[model samples]
Target: MKLDVLALSGVFDTGLATVLDTLATANELAAAQGWRTQPFDVRVVGLRRRVRTALGLQVPVQPAEVANGAVADWLVLPAIGAKMPPGLIDALATREVREAAAHLRERHAAGTHIAAPCIGGFVLAESGLLDGHDATVSWWLGPLFRERYPKVRLDESRMLVASGAFVTTGAAIAHLDLALWLVRQVSPELAAVTARYLVVDTRPSQAPYVIPDHLAHSDPLVARFELWARQRLAEGFSLDVAASALATSPRTLQRRIEAVLGRSPLGYVQDLRVERAVHLLRTSRVDVEVIAAEVGYANAVTLRALLRRKLGRGVRELRARG
Candidate 1:
């Protein structure tokens, strides 16, 4: 398939890198599978002929000269930074970007795929492309994103989310997951190979996913500490340790957790540990002792107790179904 991508210059560096790199990986994998791949005709479209990075580096693109081009089968805007300049906003309002968005939307209406990663979702959302769709964005922007576009169902916890022909990703590296998903949609072997090449796990679904809404708003310290704790759950987790990570008292962390999720910090952590334990039991044939150690329980008895408490079943019973 001929995939043409629209990338904006001067967007968030990390977001841009994730989109471009992932697309490159997908294209490489597709070729190995005998799926003819077209070079991405990337047009760095902006208000000016020269695009400059936030760091003062400048790049030259084909003169905003091609005003009339064929609409692509796929349109991707990786990120547009946090805010558009007044002049750029005026240009957008006057229908420059709107025209491009409309062209993509028309193709999408005809079954083409459209995608946005991180802040680029804002551009699509503004053009009414995301109305009545489930989408995602950088977690830091969730509150403002929700306030700006209430029509879009925002699920920030998912690495990536797709609605119909429109695929959206939350935060940075999630863009890679979205690309792998698209590669899988087009060809599963290509997706698997590409994942191997990139050393990333294969995310094989194009449909939206259900995950904890972790990226939604939380007190700053609470969010950071929770994420840190999640990553370390295999070692062990504690409210006191999490509070120390936040440079705050355990009571403060407890209060913040209650304010944000209506649960104590430890309770939330326990939920995550139990959730992982359940997933391990269901998906892997590993022994319960290993699963216990993998999910922060120091002993099989602790794991068994948690399994019964959280799932009302023993680990063995949960595994029996699979």
Candidate 2:
């Protein structure tokens, strides 16, 4: 497959390297196994010949003018290194990003598979290709993603989602997952061999690592609700009571919460409780029943069920991992 990795200015250096290096390693590992791996002609193409990363690392990139003319089977967009909203805004408005977005649109029109992971998903989203597709972004960027691209169905919970030719994954290291997945698309055995060599464990969901505090802070109402929820965590939550205490009606609370966080108020509270339970399970020797109560569940039975439903693991299983 002819693949081009778009290396833009202010790009996160590690994310760009992860996809390029992992694919190269996959080819090597597959050959070691006496298997015929898919041919990957991966090139690091950029808007300029030399681009400075967010950390000011000087990276030599093939002039995008050159690769822009080459037909590619896949175009990979790596994450940008803007953590704050203003930085994200500025990065997206940069000349490199605009040029890259235009190229991505062209590639999609030509039927190239668009693969992006982490904050790079923003570029894909900007191209309007992800419209009406099940997509995901870096977990913390969920609200911004949804707000900026309303046409796309953004699910922050997934680490990987393949919708037709467009494949996206969540966060930094998922770039490796995307690479291995592309390998798996060619040959499952090759992906297996590459994964073993790299000690890359395949993780399906981003649920375990999502920090509610970080996501909530993006919206003042959500942040206020988070504080209120944590204070009453041991006592459980009532939507009506919460609305009254927060000086909002149940209808307004539900609407804003759903619009901003893409989850109901109840769901948000549950996330807080589950996060609390996970920490307690990992650090404390508390019994499951007591932990459940501490997290606002009436009993261990319900908490265990919720844990299985939300985390895909039972209480004992989570404890075992800890």
Candidate 3:
């Protein structure tokens, strides 16, 4: 497979390196293991002839237009260094990034499979190709992405989401996952071998790593609701009561929470409860049943099911990891 790694200026250093290293390792392992599939032909393409990473390291890159002529089978966009919304917005508004987005749209039109991880999802969304597609971004950027690209179905809880020809992954390190997924497309065996050699494990969901409070604070109403929810974790969540306490109607409260967090009020409470349960499991030697009660679950069974649903892990696994 021919792949073009689009390296934007001020790109996340680790994200770029992970993509290159993972694909390079796959190529080596494919040949060494005598795999029938051909090795990936990868090149770093950029808006300019040279660009610097967030850390000021200069990288030589082939002109993006040159790569456009070759029609790479895949175009991978690594996260840019704009870690925050304001910085990311500023970066996206620049001439270079807009040009890059235009280039991305062109590539997608020409039948290149597009993949981005972390803030690179922002670029894909900017190009408008992710519209009407199920995608994911860095969990912390979930609110911004949803608000900015309302047409795209944003599921930040997923570690990776593939929709048609566009693939998106969560956070900076998910670049490895994206690369492994691409390798899997060619040869699942080679992908597994590459992952084992790189000491990388499959992370299917970003839910376990999400800090609900961080996302909640993006909206004042959501932040207030989060505080209220945490204080009442041991109590049954009542949307009417919460709305009354917060000086809003239940309908308004529901709309705001759904709009801001992409989940209903009760769902956010469930998230809070799961987060608290995980914390208690890690920090306290409390029994599972007691911890479950503390987090508003009726019994250990209920909490276990919830943990498995939200985190894809059991209490024992969470405790061990903690």
Candidate 4:
């Protein structure tokens, strides 16, 4: 496949490398297995011929025109890294991002398939290509994405979402999933072999890894609630109590949270509890029961079940890795 890795300015260095190197590795594995899969004809392209990544690494890329003229069967958008929310907001409004959206619109109109990982989805969404189409973005950016692109059905929970011509993945590392998906589309057999060689596990969703605390700062009411929730996580506070603490009506509190965070108050608190439980599990040498109680769970059994159901991990397994 003729693939163009469209690296915009301020792109995440790791994301660009991940897509290119993983696909190259997949090709090598297929060749070793004597499979006759067509190798990926991948070129890194940018709005400009060159750009600096967020880490200040200089990367050379083909001019935008290189992606045209049937040279590209698929256009890949890698995530851009921004240190702060303001940084991301600034990036989305930049000429580089807008040019990327325009280029993607043109390419899609010309029948080129589009695949974007994490924040790259913003570029595609800006083009209106994902309008009325189901898409996925980094879970932490869920609120901003929904606010900016309401017409596009945003499913931030999914690890990957494929809506016809477009394929989008969540989380920064989801480029791994996107690469495997692409490899599979060409040859499931090769994809299997490649995955085995790479030890790429099947990750179905980004929900478990989402940290509500980090996302709460986007809205003031939510931020205040997050502070209150964290203080009372072990005690368990009711929604009405939380609203009163924040000096807002329960219904309005719910409304503000739902509008920005896309999570119910209950869901938000549960996620908070789980996130704290995970930290204790990974960093603490204490018993599971103690850790569970510390996170407001009554017992280890409940926490264990939540870990398994949400993160697809066991207590023993998490500790061993930690």
Candidate 5:
């Protein structure tokens, strides 16, 4: 498979290295294992001939203008160095990002499959190709992404999401997951072998790692609701009561929460419950039943199901990690 890895100035060092290393390993393992999978022909392409990573490491790249009219089968975009909303917004308005977005739009028009991980999704969204597609971004940037690209269906909870020809992954480290997914497209066996060699485990959801409080603080109303929700966790959630406390109608409260957090009020409440339960399980040696009750669950069974659904792990795993 022919692949072009887009290298932007101030790109995330780990994100770029992860994609390059994973694909290189896949190629090596496929050949060494005598597998019949097609080898990945990867090249680092950039708008300029010389690009520097976030940590000031010089990256040698082939200028996109001199690609000799070659169209790659896939174009992989790693996250940029901008780690926060303000910095990311500033970076997006620069000439480099605008040019890259234009170049990406042209590539997509020419039938190149695009994969973006972490804040790379911001660039892809800027290109407008993901406007009507389902995609995922770094969980912490969920609110900003939603505000900037309202047309795109953003699901920050998932580790990876594929829609049409675009595949987006959550967080910086998910670059590895994106690379493995590409290898799987060629040969699932080869992908598995590559993963095992790299000692990388599959992470299906970003929900387990997301900090709800951080996202909630993005909007004042959401922040207030979060505080109220925490106080009511052990007492059970009542939307009407919550709205009354916040001096708003239930419908208005639901709208505000959904617009800010991309989930209903009750959904956010459940997230708070899960967060509390996890904390209790890790910090204290409390029984599952007691913890569940503290988190507003009626019984241990309900909490167990919730933990497995949200975290993809049982109480035992959480305790062991604790």
Candidate 6:
């Protein structure tokens, strides 16, 4: 499959470099695997007919205006800077750019997978590809994006979020995650081989943390459950209750919990509750029994056992440290 890595001018230096490096690694892997790797065809298309790097390197590109009917197997937009290029900005403000974005969106909707890193989400969002879709961008730009594009859901915690054909990364070096994910999607064996070639030791998986701040509100059901649980910690919070509120049975809810979070409903809830209790114990003046009840534990004994199992710290030790 031919993959097109389209690099835009004024793209973030760090994010762009990471994406290019990963793509190069993938290309190398594809060549080694005897897959037909198209070099010139894996293009860097210009939005306004000319592309210039922030460091003054000029890149001549086949403008997007002429790319209609292009059979692109994969479309990638690397991370862009917060500020856009003048020519590109003007193009985006024009009818042609709007139409081009629309065409790209249609192709994407028809099952052409797309990957955008960091601020490149702006491009996808402009194409209306991200409407009502959960995604992550750099943490610093989250508020500005929310202010500008009220329709697109912004997540800041996750390294990346896959919504249909579109995949987006957050700030920092999330390009690594984006590239790795694309490699896996295109060819798992190729991705693994590439990872080994690059000496990269790890892969992106859901980190064990309460809320995972980047994706805290990615899922409405989980977001609402978290909000409700926070406010009603003392009100006999249970998986059944949460499932009922979401209009799903416990079994269905458990399945979703495993699918999204890789954990059972009760297990996830208990972890959240333990996280809360640990925070309360360390930060609050509340006594153990009250804090236990506040976090939905029935009694000190059960709470202690849970703390030992989950927190790995006795309640007394946790409280004493603070």
Name the top TM-score candidate. 3
Residue 39 of model 5: what lDDT? 86
Please give the lDDT score at residue 258 for candidate 3. 90
Query: How would you encode candidate 5's per-residue C-alpha lDDT over 95-191 as one tens digit per residue?
Result: 9999999999999988899999999999999999999999999999999999999999999999999999999999989999999999999889989
Question: For residues 221-247, could you state the per-residue lDDT of candidate 4 as single tens digits?
Answer: 899999999888888658899888889
lDDT of 2 by residue, 1-322 (tens): 7888888888898898888888998777767767665467787888877887878898777865435466788888889899667889888887777778888888888778999899989988888889999998888889999899989898898899999889999989999989999888877887888898888798888888899989888889889998999999998578999999999999998988888888899998999999999999988889989998888888999988888878888767887888
Over 4 Å off in model 4, which ranges? 55-60, 66-71, 155-157, 199-202, 235-237, 283-301
Candidate 2 or 1, higher lDDT: 2
What would the TM-scores of all predictions be?
Answer: 0.56, 0.93, 0.97, 0.85, 0.97, 0.57
Q: Rank candidates by lDDT, best first.
A: 5, 3, 2, 4, 6, 1
Q: Give the poorly placed runs of model 3, Cα more than 4 Å off.
A: 35-38, 66-69
Q: lDDT for every model? A: 0.65, 0.86, 0.92, 0.85, 0.93, 0.66
Per-residue accuracy of model 3 over 1-322 as CA lDDT, tens digit each:
9999999999899999999999999888887887666579888989988899999999889888744367899999999999998999899899988998899988988889999889999999999999999999999999999999999999999999999999999998899999999999988988999999999898999999999999999999899999988999999989999999999999999998998889999999999999999999998899999998888989999999989999999988989987
RMSD of 1: 9.5
Q: Per-residue CA lDDT of candidate 6, range 1-322, in tens?
A: 5566665665566666676687787887677767775332366665656666656667666654326665677777775554433443453465644654675686586566788777677677788888898887665455445645667766554567898778888755677778777778777887788778877744242222334323325456656655766666666657787888878787877665554444466665676677788888889888888888887878888889988765456877888886
lDDT of 2 at 26: 78
- Look at candidate 3 and give me any clashing residue pairs: none
TM-score winner, 3 or 4: 3
Model 2 reaches what TM-score against the true structure? 0.93
Cα error, residue 160 of model 4, in Å, equals 2.5
- Top lDDT model: 5
* Order by TM-score, highest first: 3, 5, 2, 4, 6, 1
Candidate 2 contains a number of clashing pairs equal to 0
> How accurate locally is residue 156 in candidate 5, as Cα lDDT from 0 to 100?
97
**Stretches of model 2 off by over 4 angstroms after superposition:** 35-38, 65-70
The TM-score obtained by model 5 is 0.97
